[model samples]
Target: MKRTQARFDVVGQLGALRRYARSLTRDSSDAEDLVQDALLRACENRSSFEAGREVRPWLLSILHNVFVDKTRRSKSESLRIKGLAEMSPKQLDAPQDHSVRLAQIRAAFMKLPEEQRTALHLVTIEGLSYQEAADTLAIPVGTLMSRISRGREALRSFEQGRDQTSLKLVGGRDVS
Candidate 1:
C-alpha cells in the first residue's frame, strides 16, 4: 500500500497511540503490534482521517478497529498470532516504590471493560473532548458519556477498596 505522506506529523501521535493501545490490549507487547498495525493502516488509508479533523482521535479510531478485528479473528480461529505479542518494547520496570503504586492503579484500570477503558483513555489520558471521543468510537455522545461515567465510578470504587493510609498514586509519564 502506498502512503501519501500526511501533511500533519503522524509520529507526534505515537505516545497517545501507544497509551490507548495499552489500555485496549492490556499488554504492552500486543499494544505495540496494535499501534504498528494501526499506523500502517492509517498510512495506507488516508481517507480514514479527513483534513482539518482531529488526527489523534482518527488514529485512535483506527487502532481501536484494528484491535477489534484482530480479537474477532483470533476468537474465530482459536489461535492468536503469538508472534505479535512477542513484539515487546523490551522495557524495563520502573522502581518498585513507584512501579508498585502505578501497577496497582493500572491493574485497577485494566479491570474495566474494554469499552469503558477505551472511553476513559480517550477522554482522560488523551485529553479528547467528549464529542471527539464519541466520533472516534463511532458511538453517540450520550453513550460515550455513560461509558466515561461508569468507568470513573469503577475507578473510584477501586480506590475506595484500597488501603486508605497509602501514598498517593504516582503520576509517572510512562503509561506502560
Candidate 2:
C-alpha cells in the first residue's frame, strides 16, 4: 500500500509531464511515449530522492536526458545504416513524375545557392518571421531580407517558365 501511495505521488504530475514533453518533441505520440519512459525511470530511481525536494522538475530533467540519449542512439544507428554501400543504379532509374509543377518548383529551389534556399525554406515553408528566421539561422536581418528577395525572384522565374510551357502545350495565346 505504501508503494502504491508513492506511485500516486510520483504520477500526479503526469499532465505537466506531458505538456513539457510535447513542447520538446512537438508530436503527440512521441510526447506520450517520452512521458511514459520518464515515469518509468522516475519510478526506478525513486530511492535517489533527497527527501524534501519537489520531484516534478527532477523527473523532467531525467526525461530530457532520456530523450537526448535516445535521439543520439537513433542518429548513430542511421549513420551506420547509411554507411553500407547500397549504391545500385537500379534505385536511381525508378520512373517518377518529372513534370509535376510542384516537383519543378522544388527542383528550381534546389538550384538556388544554399543561403537563399535556407532563408526561403525557413520563412516560407517553416513560416518563421524574418527576424525569427534570421536569429535561428544566425544571420543578420538585412542578409535574411536579401536572401528572401532573391529566393522569391527565382521562384517567380521558375513559375513563369512553367506557365509558358503550359501555354505552349494548349496554344500560345496569352489570355490576358
Candidate 3:
C-alpha cells in the first residue's frame, strides 16, 4: 500500500485508538500523548503492516506496546510523585455520595494487575469479543478468560472488603 493510503487508514481508526488509550491511561493528556506516540511508531514501521489485515487491531497492538514502554520508563517517577503527594497535608473536602462511590470503584479498578485490567477493559469497555481481545493482546483465549475472571473477582473483593484467599475458601473448600 502507498504511504498516503496507509496513513489515511490509520487516521480512520484514530477515535477508537484514543478511546482505548484513555481507558488505559485514565488521563486525557496522557492518553493523547500515548495515541500520538503509537501513531508515530506505526507510521515509522508501516512496512511491517500487512496490506490485507485490519488496521484497528494493528493500531491497538501498537498502542498497547507504547503504553507498556511508557509505564516501564515512568515507574520510578510515578513512585516519587506518589510518595511526595502522600507526605503533603490532607484535605477534609468531601464529594457527593454517588461520586464518592464511583471514585472508590474507579480506584479499585485502577488497583487491579495490569494484565487483568487490560483484559477486562478490552472485553467489557471496548466491546471486543474474546477472540478479538485475545488477538489484540497476543494471548490464548483461555489466558484472556482467566485474566478477565481474576480481574472481576478482584474488583468484587475490593467492593466486599474481602481478600481473594477468603473468597476462595468459602464453605470449607476452595471455590476458585
Candidate 4:
C-alpha cells in the first residue's frame, strides 16, 4: 500500500512534467526524454522533497535545471562540431520537401530568441498562468508577458502559410 501510494503520487505529476517538457523541446521524443530524466532525478533525490511542500513544482524545477544543463552542453558541442561561422540561417534551413511544414516550424522556433521561446513554452504550450510562469522563470511578470507576445507573433507569422491557425491542445484542462 505504501509503494502504491508513492507510485500514485509520482504518476499524478506525469502530466505536468510532460507538458513542461513539451514546451521546452517542442518535440515529443525530446519531451519524453526530459520527463524521464526529471523522474530519475526526483527519485534519486526523494528525501530532499520536503513534506507538505508541492511536489509538482519541485519536480519541474529539477526539470528546468536539467534542461539548462543540457542546453549549455549542446550549444558548446554544436559550436565545436559546426564551427561558429558555419552556423547560419541558410545552413540551418536545409531543404526538406517531405517535411517542409515540420521543418519550417522547427526552424521558426529555433530562430526565436531564447527568452521568447522560454516564455512561449511556459505560458502558451505548458498552459501555465503568467504569474506561475514568471515565478518559475524568476522573471518579472511584465517581462514574461512581453516575451510571450513576441513569441506568439513570431510563431504566427512563421506558420502563416498553413491553413490551421488554432492550437491543437492535448491533455485535460484544469477548468477550475
Find the candidate with the highest TM-score and give its number.
Answer: 2
Clashes of 1: 0
**Candidate 1 colliding pairs:** none
TM value for model 4: 0.43
Better structure of 3 and 4 per lDDT: 3
Per-residue error (Å), model 2, residue 78: 0.7
- What's the ranking of the predictions by lDDT, best on top? 3, 1, 4, 2
* Native-to-model Cα distance after best TM-score fit, residue 49 in candidate 4, in Å: 1.0
Question: Lowest-scoring 10 consecutive residues by lDDT in candidate 3?
Answer: 163-172
- Local distance difference test scores for all models: 0.82, 0.78, 0.86, 0.80
For candidate 4, the per-residue lDDT at 137 reads 94
Q: Point out where model 3 deviates above 4 Å.
A: 1-8, 76-176
Per-prediction TM-score to the true structure, in the order listed: 0.41, 0.45, 0.41, 0.43
Question: What is the TM-score ranking, best to worst?
Answer: 2, 4, 3, 1
Candidate 3 lDDT over 1-176, as tens digits, reads 47647645876898999999999999999999999999999989988887677888999999999999999879978999999999987875466877988988887777776888899999999999999999999999999999899889888888788745433322346555
Point out the higher-scoring one by TM-score: 2 or 3: 2
Worst 10 residues of 4 by lDDT: 167-176
The per-prediction tally of clashing pairs is 0, 0, 0, 0
For every candidate, C-alpha RMSD to the true structure in Å = 28.2, 20.5, 25.8, 28.8
Give lDDT: candidate 4, residue 157.
74
93-155, model 4: which lDDT tens digit per residue?
445764887876877776677888888888767999999999999999998998888677768
